[model samples]
Target: MYDNYAKVIVKGSPITKSNFKLFNVNGRAILPMNSGKYHDRYAIYEEEIAFNARSQNPSKVLDEALIAVLKVYYKSEKRHPDTNNITKSIFDGIEKSGLIINDAQIRRLIIEEFYDKENPRFELELFGESSFSMDYSIKPREILEEKITYNPPSNKKKALNDRMNISAIKPKISDNICEVCGKGTCKENLISANKGKTLICRTCFKKLF
Candidate 1:
């Protein structure tokens, strides 16, 4: 079986599906601006994953089925969003990023969550089609941790440190709206930002700083 793995460090508090509210626009259902903004934050990391996937030759379309396993470490000062919703957002982000041709190709999926103060990230493990049956009963994080710990890699700590060391930069302006405030629009340099993470309004930004 062909197996590949990737680790993505996510920025900001994890967004859940419940954070999104659908509203009508010209008789069509659409997500509110805030939800789009949140999802977009996570979407930026798609490029990072795509770049790392060069060696894996991630199939844009799968000839055979595969099982996808995801383990998420959520970082935040506040309580985290619901687990199911976090997984939903991750699935959407990965699909949009072309991590897989479609999430549907995944015959089996495993999800687990952990809390991290300094480094919040998601680790993905893709097992290529095999003649053997896929095991869905194992706890993803426990097994992964056991393997990593027993066969420790030298770069493990350094990698975690690098992900946690991201500094605040300027927030991008999209259609004049600050991604964080959702209400604040048309202001350039809304707030200090983290790469691939947050975009808040000056007001909220000041509050945090």
Candidate 2:
């Protein structure tokens, strides 16, 4: 297992043995495991920072679905939405479209399963577990957060994902209502949100935004 960590990291994944670890069978010594079966990882998290089209706010997943709907409605197989250029007009289209899932529980389905890299087209299965992801990688929000340093990606799709971050943020207009109050916007009401949409109250938007 130690060798596996070395080999895997040696192959790639700069995670050192110290970084890629779990308790050993004896339950005291920490050792690196290669199975990559960490449950907390690949699972949606309360404090987990999501940084992509398929992440950020759970409801934002609908934005992706609407994009697909636009492609179909327009009868085009190739579409590249300038998320950097989303306007109130585009948002209205998403809100009016029947494909939108307003409920939070269904959110995991859309982001985790439906819009995933493997399944780009819509596939709404009733009984299935959500896709697993890790919080370790900073690639998702690497550009947005200034404190961290990031190395750019070489893969074509990853390069695309890396480039299109939620840059179209609008400042909060309301102070009384928590920006994320009714929405499943944050881990808890502990936050509203500010991925650039939905006016987040000053209190909620301050820390993360």
Best-fitting candidate, scored by lDDT: 1
- Please list all clashing residue pairs in model 2, or write none if there are none: 42-132, 42-133, 169-196
Number of the top TM-score candidate: 1
Q: Measured by C-alpha RMSD in angstroms, how accurate is candidate 1?
A: 21.9
Off by over 4 Å in 1: 1-13, 21-63, 76-78, 136-209
Q: Which 10-residue window of candidate 1 scores lowest in summed lDDT? A: 143-152
Give one digit per residue, the lDDT tens place, for model 2 in 1-209: 11101000001011112222355677773432235565333122111211222231233233121112111011122332332232222222223332234322232222221122332322122111233222333357635664634444366768566556533342332333455544333333343335635555445556656
Candidate 2, superposed: residue stretches over 4 Å from native: 1-88, 103-129, 132-209
- Candidate 1 lDDT, tens digit per residue, 67-113? 67677777853457667776666655566556566667668777887
Total residue pair clashes for candidate 1: 3
